[model samples]
Target: MRFNRSSCDKCLDVCPVKAIWIDDQGLHIDRDACTGCMLCNSICPADGLSIQNFNFQSVLAKLKDLQSPVLSCHVVADNQAHIKIPCLGLLSETHLAVMSILAEAPVQLNLTACKKCVNGVVVNKLQKSLFAVAAKLMNGSAPKIKLIEEKADLHFRPISYTRRGFFDALRHMDFPETIGYSGGLPAGDKPKAYADKAVPDKIKMLNKILPMLPETLKNWVYENYYYHLRVDSNCDLCLSCVMICPTGALKIGGDGSTGKIVFSSAFCNGCNLCAEFCSKNSIDIIKGFSGKNPSAYASCEAAT
Candidate 1:
């Protein structure tokens, strides 16, 4: 968000309801008109937007036990979906990719209620993101997402397991515990400086799920979802990059040294603020995964 070299209009372009605007005070949202579609959050490379009701972690936890997963929007009543999201647009590429990776079969997505829903505009965004996820997560092979649109005003019936089968399947599955993702300060506590600018919870959750993926798929996750840094000798450990980094992706951390700058691909968020603000012009980013720990991978040592 602090990157001022060039302005970004990605959020404005994707807001289906036109609830976002900008002025001298910075970005503003018309909460009254905002439909909470979350297309802006999904599209923002820098994560400049925030939404309190977007809860995909709980949805993902429920899908983990099911061999085959079907997701639908909440507008669809009596749906056979394994779980329902507020809207399909709430899912960014990262969420969809993670879901597909965990499921054994193609992830069935029911968009049958879009046409009749007020938030139906997100359907276009959903289609684009799903295709992108398929290319990266499945290597452009058979589509990972099987979208079920309305057929002659009639929705396709997905195979819904009996409640007994649901509980029984849960028992046989050797699954780990659910992703109990909860964060925030205690009751009335307030955030200190730059706390909100730190690494996002979603990125943390993605790394938490990494170990569960197969070896081959893990490698793909590194190459696609993550990124690395390339620093030249111009860096003098001035600590500018680390301080300016909104996501805490760049930090003066090492195995056991003071003059080392660590880079975490998972927390980078593709903001490029570190490189843009670097006075020495020493830092460069190598996009795509670096085949290392996305959470904590050392790139170059700072000049002592």
Candidate 2:
């Protein structure tokens, strides 16, 4: 998450409305000011600060019913999409990739009305997320995407609802008590203490999606998403990585003698905390790891 306390303010940086910030009390969001453009959700490496949480099971169920699944932002969708989201900017590469895999067809994105919207920033973010999905595609072919950018497209914004109502219903929804703290409260209201316990949504999605990779593409997909950790004989068994890891991906296991590290690829969110905290420098992430620092991967091993 925060490699350093001052590092990794991605959600704060990407917000078009400048709705997010952090102070002594903790992170805060100007709820009323937040347009719910959702750029913050797809960009946060820690998977923190998602104002719109989707039920993927329901998404999948709907996806199966529509042979020609069309996805669009609420502004332009107007009953046109099988999946209508507040903004395409909120979608991560995992979302695009999963939908593509499930549909077994190009996932259509309606972008014809994007330039007309004040939230034009989402177009760029959506492009970048699509690019990320494309890179992991083993064939190095174009991503499974069909962009509906023609001006004549039938799926245009409707005038029934004003822009102000895009996410007005958020306050009335029955969600967790802490959900309201993400945004929509007065400036004086601070969020509850950071619940650093939940495994981010992206991590869960990655775990499930990897297993669905076709046999031929599976190895290449693993190289793109997972890492292998190596440990040298010099390890002190300090287990600092285990302590610092936000996800319990790394552990040490043994019967009676000669303990060795165990890594669960499913839980690793690619935070690379274990690589940074290793005092021995014995941890080396061999491949498939990318971070702010090229050198800080893991013990004699690769990062997952």
Best by lDDT: 1
Clashes of 1: 1
Candidate 2 TM-score, true structure as reference:
0.71
**RMSD in Å for all candidates:** 6.0, 7.7
Model 1 per-residue lDDT tens digits across residues 136-239: 77877756567777644333445467999878756743332222113211122232344346666557667878988888878887777777787887788888
Candidate 2: misplaced stretches above 4 Å?
A: 1-6, 23-26, 51-53, 75-79, 154-197, 232-235, 255-257, 277-304
Task: List, residue by residue over 180-246, the lDDT tens digit for candidate 2.
Answer: 2232322342333322445667666655665566755656555665666677777788877766667
Scanning candidate 1 in windows of ten residues, the lowest lDDT window is 177-186
